[model samples]
Target: MMQTFLDLKAKQPEDLPSIIKIAFGLAAFFPPVKSEIRLDFFDDQLNEVQKEAVSFALEATDLALIHGPPGTGKTQTLIEIIRQLAARDLKILVCGPSNISVDNIADKLGPFRIPMVRIGHPARLLPSVISTSLDVAIKYSSGGMLVNDIRKEMDEKLNTSKKTRNGTERRKLWEDIRDLRKECKVRERRCTEDIVRASKVVLSTLHGAGGRDIIRQNFDVVIIDEAGQALEAQSLIPLVRGPSKCILAGDHLQLPPTIPRTDKTSSLRKLELSLFERIIKLHGPLIKRTLSVQYRMHEMIMKYPSIGLYDSLLLADVSVRSHLLSDLPNVIKTDETQEPLVFWDTNPHGGFGEDDTGAHESKSNAMEAALCRYHLRNLLEAGVQPKDIAIITPYNAQVALLSGLIKSEFPDEFSEIEIGSVDGFQGREKEAILLSLVRSNEKKEVGFLADERRLNGICLLQNSHFLGTVP
Candidate 1:
């Protein structure tokens, strides 16, 4: 694919979009081109910054960026941009760094009545988006119905072939089945192509965008969500399709693209820098807009990170200023002050000391695991549903320990709660988060916890309350 892009650039530069040329350093980077097009706002609930982002996305001719702080309604703003672009009859391709990110955008757009289709394996898709997946969409198309009919006939023939006694008759049946299967394959491909051509929007993960079905289609606009988490090369896969306009939205302050720890080469280190971050650094405010107001975290929970990470620019909406677990009816307060943020010291003298002895060199503290289980039981007993809570740790060993502890204690009741690494919880939110910072020793070495980006992700994983077991 990279070779193809290079070939096009060398021989057919005019056919390539300006955005692609600028990204590859083939052309001088220019500021956003102002458009005379005026659009009526589709969503009245948009904040002033969100509205500005939507307008800037529409006006920028080559490239645009949106720096969405945690819970600032970045996905909502992206949906409006897509809607307005589609209103102008432009075909748009929406790509994300991961499957969950793409599904999130699709889930929100599902209610907008847009003709969009998600491209990826059905099994990887969330349940809410399965209905809009390529396979499901094809199944309901006219051609899909034809393929189903052929498949039904093939199934009947195979069943008969299995029961037939005569060898000649059975061979004939098998041959007929083979021919029917071939026909089904041809029809399914055509059906897939038809769906891709008719849809106004195509959604896929960055690598999935390179699939043959999507590569053949043209997009007028390309929008990448969570762009800060995608590698530069990964982000280019969809942009190489020659979209005239491009928009990248994500919080560069959060977790960056995961680079293997063993890869200390300078080249690999450079690749860790995402395209979204690179562009903003090179162009400053000219090509980007920051979404200043957040709607997800409580004010008290949002206070520290807002001042520390966002330079005091992030603000919690009035509706969630005092959001707390105790505010829910029949819930028990875990602390007298009912503070949204609570820290339990897990040092050697405090709660529990960390150890890698039985964890295969990955960090895990039994004391923290036991504390996490205690908190889960408290929330469940106080009326919090298992689905509204999540446990986040920075190590896989700690994740496994927490899962085992939760299962042994509740068995079936707490099975719905999610337990995973901080990286796994990006672009996700829950009512409450139980964090285990599994690092403690005599020297007080912090290890990978020193990555501020990872800490940024940990800070945004909860909506109302946060509980941490710190070393």
Candidate 2:
């Protein structure tokens, strides 16, 4: 996969520089339509900022960046843009770094009644969107009835062969069954190709797009969600499929592409800076537009990232600022003012230890895990739904420790509550969050705890509290 990316990069028109130049050009690539752009498909009106980005995307010929911070309605904006592009009779390739991200966009597009197909492992996708799976694509494109008929014949022959007593008849039945199965395989491939060629919108993970069935396909526009979390090479894989315009939506300040530690100075590691990060750093926002209005975080939760990371560019929407956990239990609040943020100091003495995987993972603090259980019980007792609370930590070992602790102690309490590492918790949210900052040591030699991006993941919540520290 890395070699394919390198080969594609080498063959790229001007090694990405030329593409950037073409993408950033102000020339109007999309011809003006006879009628003005209308966003009737949206249930609600697009905010002014969102509307501007849509207009820019429709008019721009080259590359475009939709700087969607958490809760900024990035997926909604992309859906709108996709509809408008389709209205122009253009094909779109919607892709992302991971299956989860791609499935999310595909899921949202599901409601729009669009002609789309999601190409990847069906198990990774939601059942609602699985109808657009590659299998379904083949069925639809090649005629579902034909595929079903072939499958039905194969099934009938197998059942008959099972019932057959005569060796000669049974052998003949198995041969017919094998032929039918072969025919089914042949039809499936043809149907898949047909769907790929006919799809107005194609959804796929970056790697999934490299399939031979789609190699010859190109698109009028390409939209990549969560671009910041994708390695540069992974991002290039889908873009190689013909896309005249590219739309990248993600917050680069939150999480970066995951690079293997062993490849620290390797050529592969150097490509760790995501395409979104590279563009924004080099271009300095000339080709990017920050989606300033975020509706996810409370005023307090949005504070750190807004001022420290986003240059105070982020503003909590009115609804978000006004939202309060009115039913929050007194035990969870840090003060009488009822502010949801808390920094529960366990002052644990535990330090880092190498796990079986040999990674230096943070040792779980018993005090912190116990406190988390206490808080979760209090929240539930106060009428908070189990699903509304999320327990976030910075280490997988800590996640395991906390999860085990929760199950053993509470048994059935807050079973829906999520407990995972910060990286796994990206692109997710909860009404109230209980973060276990598991680093408790007298020396305060923070390991991955010092990473600002991982810390930013903490800020992605709506109303949250952090307990414990490296004291």
Candidate 3:
């Protein structure tokens, strides 16, 4: 696939999308298709940005980009577009950076009874979609002799029953389908090329699309969700598998690709710029439609990000901002009397150090971890739901430390608290968030802590009571 992409790049295809334009420096310009397209399958009224995205997706032949801020209904828009495409008998391939994202779309569209298959290890997929798993496709798509026999028998029975309108004959045909379904379940562990060939839509991770058995297949359109988190090389794996008509939906401002190496000055960091971010930078904001109405955060909590990151484009949807928590008496002290954002200026007392994996990771500070526990205890004692609070840090070490501290300090209440790194906590929301900035040291070195996207991540999550530490 990499060789194919390189070869295509060398040729400089004339109809590639904006991302390909930035990648290969192609000068070809294909104007957006002006023919009007409408969707009778979807009934909901779309916002202006969503309507533009749907129009661009249907009109453009090469690619379309959707800039989805937090709570902007990216998934819903993607699902509607998929419905319109499927209605036209297009073969679509849906992909993402993780199985969760792929499964999410699959789950959303599965109830529509589209001929879709979620291609991944069965153990990793949601159980509700098991019938659409790759295993079921492999089990039922082959064994030509037996399959032909069953089809021939069904046809014979249907022909004979058409004259008599016999219920007994129809009952037998139904029995054959039930047996075939059972056979698919019995052979759930086997996988074959027939899976991708039989499916009208295949959903998988970026690397999962490169399976050796299904490499030769072609799709009419490919849609990649969470495109900002995928490496440029990773995104090409799916893009090269088919023609270049594609849709990339993600927020570049929230989280970029995670590069684990600590060599900040090395040229290898160039790979961290995702294909989504690269195209957005080259083409500017006009190339993609931004979903501006945010439904996740309170008006007060939405102020910082709207001003700093989104150029004040985000407007708080009042209907969704009705859920607010009662303010704590003295736990949060700010210049304004009722501000929900709290910044704890903790002293720097820790630094980055080597982990067991021989890589330098963020060091955990006992003071900050203890402070997290203190706030969590107060929130719970004040009648806040344990599940409504989240503890986030940029470092894996701090996640482990804070998780352990929470469990030990409040064993009975530990099960409900969600603790994880900021990357793991993306696409999730909480009523009260406690952020432990793990970098603390006398040298004033902040070590991978200066990226503004982390702050953007905070804006992505829900807001009512937010407690953050600054070193």
Task: Report the CA-based lDDT of candidate 3 relative to the real structure.
Answer: 0.74
Candidate 2 regions with alpha-carbon error over 4 angstroms: 6-43, 140-144, 148-186, 261-269, 327-337, 348-362, 464-471
| All candidates: CA RMSD (Å) | 3.5, 4.6, 9.4
Task: Tell me the spans in candidate 1 whose CA falls farther than 4 Å from its real position.
Answer: 1-17, 24-28, 33-38, 148-187, 263-267, 333-337, 349-351, 358-360, 377-385
Candidate 2 residue lDDT tens string, 1-471: 564556665664554533444433422233323236464545366798888777766766667788988888888888899988888889999889888898888888887777888898778888888998987666555366688999898888899989989999999998998888898878777777778778899998888767766676877788888999987777777666446788888888887888765534466656667888877776666677778888886777788888988899888888777565654454333341255566655653342222233334345666666777887776666667777778878776778888998888767763787888788888887877887776665565566668798788777854543333333
TM-scores, each model vs. reference: 0.87, 0.84, 0.80
- Sort order, TM-score high to low: 1, 2, 3
Candidate 3 structure, TM-score to reference: 0.80
Tens digits of per-residue lDDT for model 1, 169-249: 999999999999999988888889889999999999998888877977888889999999998888988877577889999
Candidate 3: lDDT of 53? 79
Model 1, CA-based lDDT: 0.85
Which rank order by lDDT, best down to worst? 1, 3, 2
Q: Considering only N, C-alpha and C atoms within 3 Å, which residue pairs clash in candidate 1?
A: none
Better of 1 and 3 by TM-score: 1
Full-model lDDT, candidate 2: 0.73
TM-score of 1: 0.87
